[model samples]
Target: MKKLKQIVNEVKDRIAEQTPPAQLTDLLWQLICYPPKMPLRLQQEQFLNQAETFSVTVHDEYFTKKDLQINGFKWGNGKRRVLITHGWGSKAADFTELIAALQENPNLEIITFDAPANGSSDGELSNFLLFVEAAKAIIQKTGAPHVVIGHSFGAMANVVALNDLHITPSLLVSLTPFILLKENFIKSMTTVGVPADAQEAFLQDFERKYSIPASYFNMPDLYKFDDKLNHWLAYDEHDMMLPYSYLKEFLEAHPTIRSRNYDNVGHERIIKSAQVINNVVEEVNKAIAN
Candidate 1:
C-alpha cells in the first residue's frame, strides 16, 4: 500500500510538471470550423486584457449591486448618455478610449460596466445575463436618454435584452456580433458534457450554467452580402473569424439595423482605434440630435 501511494504521487508530480498542450492551434481550428463564434469570444478576451494594459480605458470601479454605488466614471453633463459594453471576458475598461473620446464633446455622458465577473464588478462567472442587467443598471443610475453599443458577446447580450427580453437601447450598435453558427458553439459546449443527439441536454445545461437560452445559438438567419463589412475596424486581413461572406449574410437578415464597416480592420483594434472612437462619437451625436 505504501509503494502504491508513492507511485501515485510520482505520477501526479510528473503530470503537473509536464508542459500543457497548446490550446492556440486547437483554438484556431475551432475558429476555422465555426468561422465566427469562437473567434468573437477569443477577441473579446484579448481585447479586455489589452484594456487592462494598453488599450482603451473605461470609468472602472467596483460597486455594490444592492445600491449600485461606486458606479463607473462620467464627465461633462452631456445631455445624451451612452452606455458601452465590452465583449466577452472584457471589462468596462476596454471602452476607456471611446469613453474618453466621446466625453470630449461636452454634450455626452459616458457609462460603461464590467460585464459580470469582469473588471471590478462582482458576480459569478456563469451569470451571462449580468451583461444585459448591468447595461440597464447603468442607464437607470445615470437617468439619461442613452445609446448602447457592445462588442462581440456584449452585442449578443444587447440583442437578447432588446429583442428577446425587450429592453430598448435608443440606438444600438453591435460590433463583430455573433448571430449564428450554432453547431460549432455546441461543440465547444460539449466540454461541459453534452453528447451528440442530446440537444435538449445541452440547452438545459447551457441555461443552468450561463442562464442563456439555447435559441441564442439557433438564432434566425441574418446576414447580407457587403464587401464594405470587410472594412470593419475588427477584421484581420490574415486571420478572420467571420469572413465577409458571413457578415453579408448576417446584415441581410437584419437590414433594419444600422452599422458601418471599415476597411481591413480586425475586431479588437477597431474597438481600440482612434478612428472608431471618432466614428462612434459621430454616430452618437447623430443619434442624440435625431
Candidate 2:
C-alpha cells in the first residue's frame, strides 16, 4: 500500500510538471506590469500582422535551432547579407524597418522569416533550441557572408547557437537578450501564470547542468568570443520585466560585445525603435567595413 501511494504521488508530480506553453504565455502577458495602454500594436498578429503591406509569406521548411528553412523572399540582391531574428512571440515581420534601413545601404541582402510559432511559420511552441537551429539553417542557405541581428529571445539564442552550432557570422547584434536572471525568471514566470510546481521544475532542469538546454548564457566558450559581436540592449530602468544589472555581465565579460543603453524605450519598443534600427545598421556596417 505504501509503495503504491508513493508511485501515485510521483505520477501526479510528473503530470503536474507538463503544463502548456500557452499558460506560461498568458502568465507572462499578465506579469508585464508595464502600464502602457498598449505597448504592442494590435494589428492582430505578433507584430507580423503589421507587416502585411510588404510582400511576405509563410516560410515552408523544417526548422530547428541548427536547421531552418522557410518559403520566404529576399528584398535585395546586395552582396552583403543581413538576417534579422525577432524576439519571443514575434514573427519575421518585426524587422521591417531594419530591413528597409539595411536595403538603403546597397551592400545588404535582407532575409527574414517567422520564427516557429510566431508568424506563418509551420511549427508551434518556439523556444531557444528551435530558434538557434532556424538561424543556423538560414545562414547556411544564404551562402554569402552574413551578419545576424537578433532581438530579445532571438538574441540570446543566436549567441549560444553561434558558439555551440558553429554558425559564425561577420557580426552579431543582440537586443534585450534574456539569459542570466536565475531567480527573477520565477517572478516573471509567476506573472505569466505558470503553476508554481512547473516553474520550479523548469528552473531545476535549467540549472542542473552548466549549459542548460536553454538559449541564454549557456556558452561553454564565452572566453572564445572575439570583438565582432555587438549587443544593443534597451531597458527602461523602471521596467518590471528584467534586471539590467545582471544583464550587464554578457556585455562586460566578452571582450567583443559593444552595448547601447536606452532609458525609457522599454522592452517591446526597443526592438524596432528608430534608434535601435539605426544602431543595428551602424553596427552591421562597421562589421562589413572591418
Candidate 3:
C-alpha cells in the first residue's frame, strides 16, 4: 500500500499537471493567502477564558473590500493599553506567557486579537495586507496603545499598519522579524513546490490583482514612515526562518534601536523563553514610564 504522504504528493502532482495555468494561478494564490488554521490548545483556551473577549471589524477597500470581524481579548483594566499581534499561522492565545508577564503591570491593559483566517476569525484566506488591516482596525477601536508587541510576520504587519495609519506607540517590540517580503515569498514558493515559471506567474498575478508590486512590502519600504518610532528588536542567532544577516544590516543602520540576541533559542521557542519575556517586560515598563 502507498503511504498516505506519498499518495497526497501524487494527487498534488496530478492536480498540477491537469489544471490549467489560470486555474493553477488561482490555486497558488489560495495556497499563499490561506495557511491551515491552528486551533487554540488546551492551555491557551484556559488562559484566554480568564480574559474579557470581544470582536472587532476590519475594513478594507481592495481584495476583501468589506468589513471582516475578528475575535479579540482584553486583560486588565489598567490605564496603559498594550496591543499584541501573533505571527502567521498563529493564534492570539499563543501569547499566554507574554500576557502573563505583562499582567504583572497593574496599570497595563493588554489587548490581543486573532487575525483574519486565524483562530476564531471569520476567513479562509489571509495575507500580510489583511493582517495589517486587522491591526489597524484594532488600534482604531482601542485607541493608541503604549506599546505594540508583534511576533515574526505579525511584527512586520503591525509596523506596516502603524505606518499607514500614522499611529506610533511609545515602543514596538518585534520578535524575529523579516525585512524582505520577496525573500519570504520565495521561501514560501519553494516550500509549496512551485516551479520557477509558476513563481513568476504568481508574482504577476499578485501585482495585477493588488495593483501594488510585491516588492513594496519589504521592510525598507514599510519602515520609511516613521524614523522617530522607537524599536525593541529581539532575534535568535539560530533562527532558521529569517537569517540573522538580513536584520543585522537594518540594526546597524539604526543604532538607536535597542536589540537583544538569544543564544540558544530559535524562532518559535524564543517566545516562550523567560528571559525574552523579562526583556519585553522591561521595555514595556520603559515605554509606560516615558
Candidate with maximal lDDT: 3
Q: Quote each prediction's TM-score.
A: 0.60, 0.68, 0.90
Against the reference, the lDDT scores of all candidates come to: 0.51, 0.57, 0.82
Ranking by lDDT: 3, 2, 1
Per model, how many backbone clashes are there? 21, 10, 0
Candidate 2 Cα misplacement greater than 4 A, ranges: 1-71, 165-167, 181-185, 192-198, 202-224, 227-239
Report the lDDT tens digits of candidate 2 across residue range 1-290. Answer: 34333433443444467645433433332232111121234543343432323222234332232332343446677788777777766766556667777877887777776665556555443445566666666665665346877777677667765676565677777677665534455665554345676666566555453356333443323324666544444455544455666566655676446566777787777766888778777878888887
lDDT of 1 by residue, 1-290 (tens): 34333433443443345423232222222222221111125544554443312112222222223422223545456677776767765666667567667766777766666655455554323233555566555555666445777787676665555444344545666667655545435545343333344434444555564466555553343222233221122333232544566556655665655556666667666677677678777777776777
lDDT of model 2, residue 33:
16
Q: What's the CA RMSD for each of the models?
A: 10.9, 9.2, 3.3
lDDT of 2: 0.57
Q: List the lowest-lDDT window of 10 residues for candidate 3.
A: 1-10
Cα error, residue 223 of model 3, in Å, equals 0.4
